[model samples]
Target: MLTEVKERLHSLGISVSSEPSNVDEVIIKFSIEKVTNHIKNQTNLSEIPTGLKEIAIDMVVGEYLFSKKSMGLLNIDSLDFGLIEKQVQDGDTNVTFAVEASSTPEAQFNAFIQYLRHDEVDFIRYRVLIW
Candidate 1:
């Protein structure tokens, strides 16, 4: 799972180096566990289902980004999440980024949390209802 998350991060242009530092590994592991646990809890299952693996990977990536941002270690511009810019005018060098970028960190994290919750809807089919 760690490898998959790193690969996903790399694919997103986040630039996780070939040899990550101990701290980096810890952060990645933490993010994976956090996301996996959330999914497991949501579905009322002890393990993540194969069908939700991709979603879990994406969520882990988001969680990792959020952790880095909160620690002031990440530059939003460095990410290629497609949520960065709304428009860019090269002629006059006018650039407009998504509204969330201009907001407070808490607000941005809230928006991120909302996005993660949106993904949780996919777990509905796997949800276990125990009366």
Candidate 2:
């Protein structure tokens, strides 16, 4: 699972190199634990079901990315100030820098965090009622 997480991170453009420190490994492990716990708690199961292995992997990836973003370590190449249309002129020299919530980093981060938090719907099918 760690290897799969590392590969997923690499595929997402996040370089999890061993050099400098083993923090990346720690983060990956933490994410896995977190996702596993979430699954167990939500499903009332002692272990993750086989059907949810892929979902768990995805959640772990999301958690890892969330951690990286929180620590300011995630490099968002899509974030470009130049690409934002701050001003538009139509023979009037009108300059307006409108900041949309969907375009800001904070907004994006919040949206992602919300996604990771409320993604239990995916695990509903595998839930076990223990009453």
Candidate 3:
């Protein structure tokens, strides 16, 4: 399951990584504009996707974290949504998150973190593609 999520993320140009530790850290980051451009380049529509551009970042990220938890992906007790980080660089919006309070084993927790950290962001593409 983790491997499949990683493959899907790679297909969508998101990257996931972490440092090995007692409390492992998983970093998920992606470019919002890159995704927008990817959609633009793939489709014939000339209008920008307002849904994507106006998306509520917190809502999306929170729901995504909960969805993965409900799917048995991890034993995340709570997500530090308040501490989530976002930035803009080179005309692209980048969002990043750090995994915390997961009860799964360190390695397993890291894998689960990697899974959602990537899958949830890439899921945005599907949302826009089908919109």
Candidate 4:
């Protein structure tokens, strides 16, 4: 599964490192732009998308003037799934979440974080052809 994800990411222009022998503590590498573009590509967009993938990419970007955290740019980090698309063409993309204390809300946030931080996503494992 991990191998397929890496290969797909590669096909999308995201470079991935070999799987670490240690699953409990592993590092997965990827590019923000590549991941963002992959997500955008999975949905319908106005353009063919040859550049900065989305406007939302700016929000989560890590703040580092020198290092310059490019939010949309995917980097190797612990998998967090709660980060929602906030916007998607194919999907409604109409969901806004907030900081909640309830178990369900927390669960949702946890999932979002997991997805956002995920090293490998199953849906993005398909190969694409460019003509």
Which RMSD does model 3 reach against the true structure?
14.1
The TM-score measured for candidate 1 stands at: 0.69
Best by TM-score: 1
lDDT of 3 by residue, 1-131 (tens): 23433445444343435343411122112233333454455443454455543332322233334444555764444432333333334556554343445534444435544543343353355443434
- Model 4: lDDT equals 0.37
- Worst lDDT window (10 residues) for model 2? 77-86
Superposing every Cα of model 1 onto the true structure, what RMSD results? 5.8
Per-residue C-alpha lDDT of model 1 across residues 32-73, encoded as one tens digit per residue: 888888888888899999999888888888888778777888
Give the total clashing residue pairs for model 1: 0
Per-residue lDDT of candidate 4, residues 8-115 (tens digit): 445434454464763211323223444455545753343324333222232112111102223333343433345533334547555544445443533553454444
Model 3: weakest 10-residue lDDT segment is 22-31
Clash pairs, candidate 2, are none
Candidate 4 residue spans exceeding 4 A from truth: 1-31, 37-108, 114-131
TM-score of 3: 0.23
TM-scores of the candidates in the order shown: 0.69, 0.68, 0.23, 0.21
1-131: candidate 2 lDDT, tens digit per residue: 88887777676556787654588788888899998998999999999999888778778988887888889887775543444465688896887665564567666555655664457787889888886
The alpha-carbon RMSD values of the candidates against the true structure, listed in the order shown, are 5.8, 6.9, 14.1, 14.4
Error at 20, model 1, angstroms: 6.1
Error of 1 at 87 (Å): 9.1
